[model samples]
Target chain A: MHYFDCCDFTIASEIAWPVSFPASREPEVEIRYRNLPTDLGEGGERGFRFHAKPNELLICVDGVARYLIRGGKEIWIEPFPHADEDSIVAFLQSSVLGVLLLQRRFLVLNGGVFNVDGEGIALVGCSRAGKSTLAAAFQRIGASLFSDELCAIKQDSSGRMMAWPVLPALSLWENTLIQQGGDVTKLRPIRPSIRKYLVPTHAKSLSPVPLTQVVELKDYHGDLLWKTVDVKEAITLVLGNTYRHRFLIGMALKDAHFLQSTALIQQSRFYIAQRHLTVTSEDAFFHFVRTNLAL
Target chain B: MKSIVWLASYPKSGNTWLRIFLENLFFATDEPCDINNLRSSFMSCSLDLFDHECGWDVSLLSHDEIDRLRPEIYTYIDSQWENVKYFKTHCAYSFTGSGEAFFPDEATKAAIYLIRNPLDVCISYAHHRGYSDYDRIIAEMADAASCLCSDTDQPFWQARQKILSWSLNVESWLSVEGFPVLFLRYEDMKNNPYEAFSRVAAHLGVNKSELEIRQAIKNSSFEELQKQESLNSFKEKPSRSKKFFRSGQNGMGYAMLSRSQVASIIANHGQIMAQFGYL
Candidate 1:
């Protein structure tokens, strides 16, 4: 049985799933799939089977399977043909990487993710809620950049939770990019929609560091308000903000993972903030972070 | 029976302006354009008022829940306000599904479809609410446009198709025999307020002298509308770093877009615009 270990969970399967061979007669990737315990109770009773076919991927659950061919961007499903294709892709991406790949663990806590020495913080919010703008602000203050979209949280053997770096990318509007001293050449046209730009961060010196806090970014109302919440509340809030997933991994495992994750968050501080509703530049955001995080 | 005129238009097309004009002409008091207060006062039997009057019974439900119960609620209110009820709706025509005619079966009610240039509409929408940037605005517009163009059978583009379908609805209602249908242009209202208001008032069976029409026009000016606290205020909680009502302007698109872009917008919604004599 080939086993892959990520933190406390170990995936072991003996099924000889078909492996695609290259011209050199070497298998490029190994595909192993099995029905394992999710442990989320009724919602987690269902199991997911994943297959990394040659240049393609297949995920099956609840008697329905989705096939993703490499060339075509659309996902095809059998028995459930009417499901939204974009939603399916988004589901696969977040689930495969966020939960299944990382071994079902809780990483974010209390509205912000803390850096190694708790010197840095990453604030995440729903799309169009000024996350990239806040990240740009932090970068302007000379803080190391991790990611603006996706971040990986892993628990070390020592029981300390760490934030793994994903892509160092930031999405901003044209006005924000210009304000942040970002170059236009770095912008890519995300078409069929308007006014969005993707700016890559140049901070390569910073690697994945230990996470301390997770701040859920919200827009400012009439006044500036910030309130620290309990870890359980923080977990619930972050879970609500997580990327949409159709099929979550092992139910019991997920609950256990979240409880453990909440423990980490409770050890730190959590907050809900209402800041001044202004389009502050990246420099101003980082300065605010420096002052708030007290780094 | 005192007739109630429904001054309906797409968002940012000047529904509030029409309301203010009517309110000033009738009430003779500048007590502010408090829509909530106005709803409870004259149009108490309308939909907006029902939500408040019923309060806990209605507000407890989610938006979707309330939307599901809207038809039943409308029926109940329709029984009460059957005689005198003037309401405004951003929804496209024929939105009232089977057996649910709140305002005289959509055929009897006076529906004044106020058409505006799509470019101006988009520009007004962009600034009226805070969007991340131009790309987001353009993307939203394109989505709306595509939805409007697609077939009715298609499930996608529910919101956009509703907007697009309004022109067809107006055309259908205009061709039909019975019910009063007045087609007004937002641009025309801007250019000739006295003529437009007089035509509307006459249709609603209201005796408006030239002076009254002129007064309504002056009172309902954009500046006056902006100054009114209720008209420019929001009841919902503000999102992170964003407000509800930002600006009110006509010809805003001219400042934001190039001539070519303007031409494209005209091309996209030209058929609807041409029907209303906007081009």
Candidate 2:
């Protein structure tokens, strides 16, 4: 058995988590390996038919595994057909964990959250927005590492949005890795089926850091246009990048996400980082972002 | 029980132009539709839409697994929306490895399959992809598994589109065993746009008058699209292309290609070329 201090939850699991945990903390969610139910019943709605729900949330990855998160305390998993092990671990570390946090009504954002000189800077965007590339480039410039893919945001005692980091690595593309002089043979692929590597970083900010700014990256072909969004739009924008906001709707935590976004925007500045849509060099884009974000 | 219109086409085949026209036909007053902000319909292979509907990051799953789960998204959309939803797809009529249809047959009510001459497609596609090889473009057009926006080495913003050959793609939609489809030819649109667009309007169930169609046609002219692109670069334009609205003429094939190049394209797609008056 392995344990992880994930966000605020003490997660005890059958699989090892990338994040660390002290055994002193009491467990909140216990993930165990078992043959999960084939169906969670017929009356509930489908989140694209890979799921069904009544009292518990059942998620199926056909020919791979099934996951049943029961009452927000236990995760039952069933591995079927394929047992690559690498992919299953990735699932636990990423989207599956994201869904659990969201089901728990905690805000999980799909972006890069890292500590930039003690102030947390998050680069949020859809895929191809270069969020990870931005984060990796920022880290290369001696910025403190945090989380690259998923991060949890919630309220703290002082009424500020605190970003609790995730895995201490970033998934970087092969082209970007080549530009950075990274050896593809050395790094581990996030999955065997993909070329994206799990490039480990230096020390990551393990505790809750105050999220100072949220920059949404967009691939604009013209030029770099950075502008601060209004508060109303900021709320919608942040929620839009909130690690599968559709899951929030599916789990009926839309209100929770709205409240979380409101709290997050209140504490952090939101900027749309519109950049050119070309195969940019590391130094060129790095200089542009560093100058604009002023990191 | 659902109204889903498909703006289906092979790449560089005036799909964007048709979309802009539709946008103007729906919501233009004194200005042309914003080229920078013209997502009238979400694409069939949109990463955001799939991620949103599945409530998970599809990048984590293999492409095959993602394909298996795609039909479910349409089912959800059909259940949720009570009105018309147009989705653009380049994927030909295909099935998943698990034998499920890639596009949900139950959800889609109609499709608009756009056909352009292969020779024009070669020039436009070469510019769009920045690859100068006419032979490769031809081979890709004839292949059964030609697709785009599927680079796995980088952060994939676009979804993987599994479009087959030019002729196969056309056949896939037009011969779906009684599925309703409206076929629009690029030559027809270029020569007699009024007739072409009016047919489109009729198929989409839009009751635009002759004047409205004329105004929309004028509004979304090739020059206007190029002008808009020059002012504020289009988000959809590939970085390699100098402009999105390149000379969208029927004879562009002749101007851009040599006689041999034209011969190569016709030889590869002779049947479909003749069928669509390209020969």
Each candidate's chain B TM-score?
0.70, 0.95
Q: List the DockQ of the predictions in order.
A: 0.04, 0.52
| Cα lDDT tens digits for candidate 2, B193-270 | 999999999988889899899899999999999998888878787777777787787778888788888887788789
Lowest-scoring 10 consecutive residues by lDDT in candidate 2 chain A? A47-56
Worst 10 residues of 1 chain B by lDDT: B151-160
Per-residue alpha-carbon lDDT of model 1 for A216-277, expressed as tens digits? 66555234445667856877666655432222232224454565556557554655554543
* Chain A TM-score vs. truth, each candidate: 0.58, 0.91
lDDT of each: 0.48, 0.77
For model 2, residues A1-295, the per-residue Cα lDDT tens digits are 8876767777888877554544448888888989777776665546663453533667766555777876668888888777666777777677777777776666777787888667888888876677788798888778876777776777888888888766667788888898788999987787788787877774633677899988887777677777888889897778678786555554667777778888888788888877776745546766877888876
Cα miss at B13, model 2 (Å)?
1.6
lDDT at residue A70 of model 2 (Cα atoms)? 67
Candidate 1 chain A TM is: 0.58
In model 2, which runs have C-alpha deviations exceeding 4 angstroms? A18-24, A37-46, A49-56, A70-72, A103-105, A202-205, A250-256, A278-283, B28-30
| C-alpha positional error of residue A223 in candidate 2 after TM-score superposition, expressed in Å | 1.3
